[model samples]
Target: MSADIEVVPSTNRKNAFRRRGLLAAAVAVAVLARVFMFDHQSLDYIAFIKRWYDFIAANGGFGALKHSFSDYNVPYLYLLAALTHTPIPVLAGVKIISVAFDLVLAFFVYRIVALRRPGGWLPPVAALVVLLLPTVATNSALWGQADAIYAAFSLGGIYFVLRRRPWLACVFFGLALAFKLQAVFVFPLLLVLALRKWLPWRALPVVPAVVLLLDVPALLAGAPLKQLLSIYVQQAGSYQALSLRAPSIYQFFPAGADAAVIRPIGVAVTGLVVLGLVAAVVLRRATLNPARIVLMATVSAILVPFLLPSMHERYFYLGEVLTVVAACYLPRRLWYVPVLVQGAVFPAYLDVLFPKGMGKGGQPGMIIGQAPPGGVATPPPGGGRGPVIMGGGPGTSMYEPTLEYRILAALMALAVISVLCTAWREFRRS
Candidate 1:
């Protein structure tokens, strides 16, 4: 009997360890898969990190870091500094940084979902689902952009604000701003919340504080204040086009549409939209619960991309994330929103990534300089405006508004309307 007891105890311990080991191995595989899977040596991989690495090599470490930037902000420069320290090739390091933030982004999505109703494995499951989301995967691993990095902070800021931790949320929002201007998609929501008294105005200074902290280092290290500020200013006119790969009403315009006309009108309309949202929140300040707040925030984030000029294919990234959060929060049939969004943007992503291999060339991450001056230099030949022409080959622009592209764009617009109308109805019922 004593011998049997000992054997049984040993077997149980072994099984426990085996389970733990297998779990660990699974995680390891996932990490490695992201790290090394799409290590295609592309030009962006060169411009983003390798070229920076070369600058560090030629200019002696951080000595030249201040003057080396094109349009990326200072927090990303800090990332570049840390990357320079690691011996892992600059390309892999860059992608790893984005991949790491991809997990952080998913975690924030989980928290957002869990805040509504915390019960069981829903949060973890949400995180995993977002982890494997197609855009999230491609942005970090395949395209190797830092969209997820700033996006994580932006999402965290929203989560904390919902949690009533305004200061921490502002810090995160600041980090998001310091990382990239795209965080603007979510920043205005905070402003609306503050104006509605959801957050204290005193908590707002953290935004500039965090921004100053990120910028001061470079400024002190010899980066010109004018040059640094001008980076964003220049971005406004960087591409004069009214639309890039973003499927929007801009798709209706002629190929060579004038952005001077579109930019001002888009700004006016975006202002009106934001004013309407702010008025709604302010007028209903009494009932502005988490549900209402999230709905408004989600709608605001989508509106910026949906209405803005010079928008890029990746611009809807925040919208996609917020839509997923809205779906979990509202838990209605939101497949339509994501399905339309991914459908509209996936072709553009393919064109950017596999331009030559697939014979479909579209815009790449020429973000800092990707905006066109006005209208496409080249529209689809003969301007076939039916639904979608089959041959959007190497020469065709993703912004060419093929028949299929227009159909997808229209679906995306309808989906946004559907989400907003549904949220409003639910808010009334609640």
Candidate 2:
């Protein structure tokens, strides 16, 4: 019997060691993949980020924050300012910042998975899956977008919320909101928790407080207080299009459809969806569980971006990650959610990264085609060259919903419905 116990201990040690080895190998592979992708200079980099970096460098690092140089929030601008002081190439430094958060995002995934499904290979595998996700990889390393930074904090918020740490959840979520307004995609999930009493209502103030608190540095550096607070407001009014290549309900409308009429309708529809989610939580608070929380988060992440106008293609980043976490939580039933979400979002990234100007034979550029009536492309904000239309002149509308985006919209709509039905069934069961 003693020998039997000794053998069991030895086997467990070997298994633990093996899991560690696998995780390390996965991390190394993920890092090397990002290294190869560091060379791609995305339009965002060339047009906006690089210029912003140079401006900060020329104007004396953090002191440059006082001027309205970029439309992005102060938190990210802080990163750009700090990058100016570093010797690393601006492109690589920006991508590296995102990659670091990509790992943090993956660690949170691992933690969330291990929280519910402990003592197994599934947790590390989930982390590996996140690091290797196509959008996650490209958003950071290839395109040099900071979606992962906000995404990492958002996931950290979700993990803490699941662990019943409401204050920490708010802090992390505040950090996310500080990075991007798109972080509001997950706000409804937090509201659901608050309504269900999983998180205390008072702790909610921590979110905006944290956002404001982080602005102190920029404020001290002479950045206008009002401007820092209203950055998101400016961002909201910056783009007039119904969709910025986002695979949303706007895709179902004609490219020439009047934005004035459609924009309000989209907002109203998104509001209704959010209200419906809140109602579900109120009606079935007892049914709330860790898996269900993830499912509802997945729903918010998908439905908000899918229904709202003025959304960018990468707005669905959280949805893609949450679907994976949802699948890990209930692999047998929800395993396909991640696949569908990724399918719906990944092509949009490809379309943006390799626009029509890049020439064909590689990634598709369905986002930029068929300029509006004027056939002129308006320069993107922050003073970069406007999107190049193959045959059209500048100052024209550069965005027209292509068949590919329409299909993506439909797929996302289907995902939203499928997840909603599943959530309803689970709530009813409880």
Candidate 3:
């Protein structure tokens, strides 16, 4: 009997070590992919560095605080500015900071996933898949974007809320909002905490209080209200065009349609669709897993911008991060799809954003075929091969179409459908 017990303990140790080894190998691959494969030339890094330097030089270090409110609401700007005094290269500093945040995000995922479903291979698998996602790796290490940081805070907030720590959750959620406007999309999920009666309804003010505390620095720095509002106004007014990536049912339409005509129509349709989904979930008595709620909110946020006319690829950052957060609670099989989609989309989007020369068998001139009116391509009156796609100009075979967009669209659709069905099923079961 003693020998048998000893053998069982020994086997457990070996299994633990094996799990650790797999995790270590996975992390190494993720890190190497980010550092060596994708960090070729980070445009976003360069932009942030230049913007940071300009902010510092123009307005003393503290003065740079104004830029945060007036331009991007990214709180990390101040953090990055604080690091400027260090001898480290700006790009290196940014990459280090982002990677650190990614690590925190990974930890948060582990905790959240483990909490939702205990003692399973699914949590670790989910965490590993999230860490390895091409987009997450590339965005954090290569582009040096702070999406990971905001995502960390968002996940932390969700975790705390799940643990019935409302105040801490509020603080973390506020910090997330300070990091990026995308955090607002998750704001509604806070009601879950209130619904659970984890905290008094009056305690809800703590969230805005924390947000104000973060913004106080800028306010005290003499940033004007007009300027502050301008940041939002600029985003709202600009980019009235449409793209295939839009999240709405409207994406089925051709691009370049008039915003006046499409905007209102799209808004009404999206509102109805959103309402319908919410009703379905609620009416079905779905199980209110905080992780799944976060996933839905994240998907909603991502789709909001996509469904809206005129969005950029970077807009998917919030959704990508939320997908990671959702992975913590998802079954292992479900986790791999998002990971693969994120990985595939990140580099492809970057390629389009910052192209190197044509790959092969590609001529220079624009491949102008007759696109219907309101399509992405604007055909001439003659209907024979429209004008060149102006941004890169003709001969930019690098701009040639690839399967990336189609793949992403398909995967995203699959994910949305799968999650919705799962939520409905779980709701019914509950």
lDDT (10s digit) by residue, model 2, range 18-115:
98998898899999999999999887777678878998999999999999878888899999888888899898999999999999999999999998
**Prediction 1 global C-alpha lDDT:** 0.70
Candidate 1 structure quality by residue, lDDT tens digits, 93-180: 7788898998789879878888986745556556666666677777788888788988899999989999999999999999988888
Model 2 clash pairs are 376-395, 376-396, 377-394, 377-395, 377-396
Every candidate's lDDT: 0.70, 0.84, 0.60
For model 1, what is the alpha-carbon lDDT of residue 56?
63
Q: Where is model 3 poorest over a 10-residue stretch in terms of lDDT? A: 379-388
* Among all candidates shown, the one with the greatest lDDT: 2
Pitting candidate 1 against candidate 2, the one with the higher lDDT is 2
Two-way TM-score contest, 2 vs 3, winner: 2
Which residue runs does candidate 1 get wrong by more than 4 Å? 1-30, 47-49, 333-335, 356-398
Give the total clashing residue pairs for model 2: 5
Q: State the lDDT of candidate 3 residue by residue for 1-430, as single tens digits.
A: 9999999989989988998898888877777666664344454333335456556656777676765423455366667667677787666767778887887888777877778777656667767766776677777777666788778888888778778787888888878876776666565455543554545587678766776677667677766656654554455554444542323333455433465787778767766766666656555655666655666665565556545554555566666766655655555535654664464356556653354432334433332332334655333222211122333442232322335555555555665665556555555666
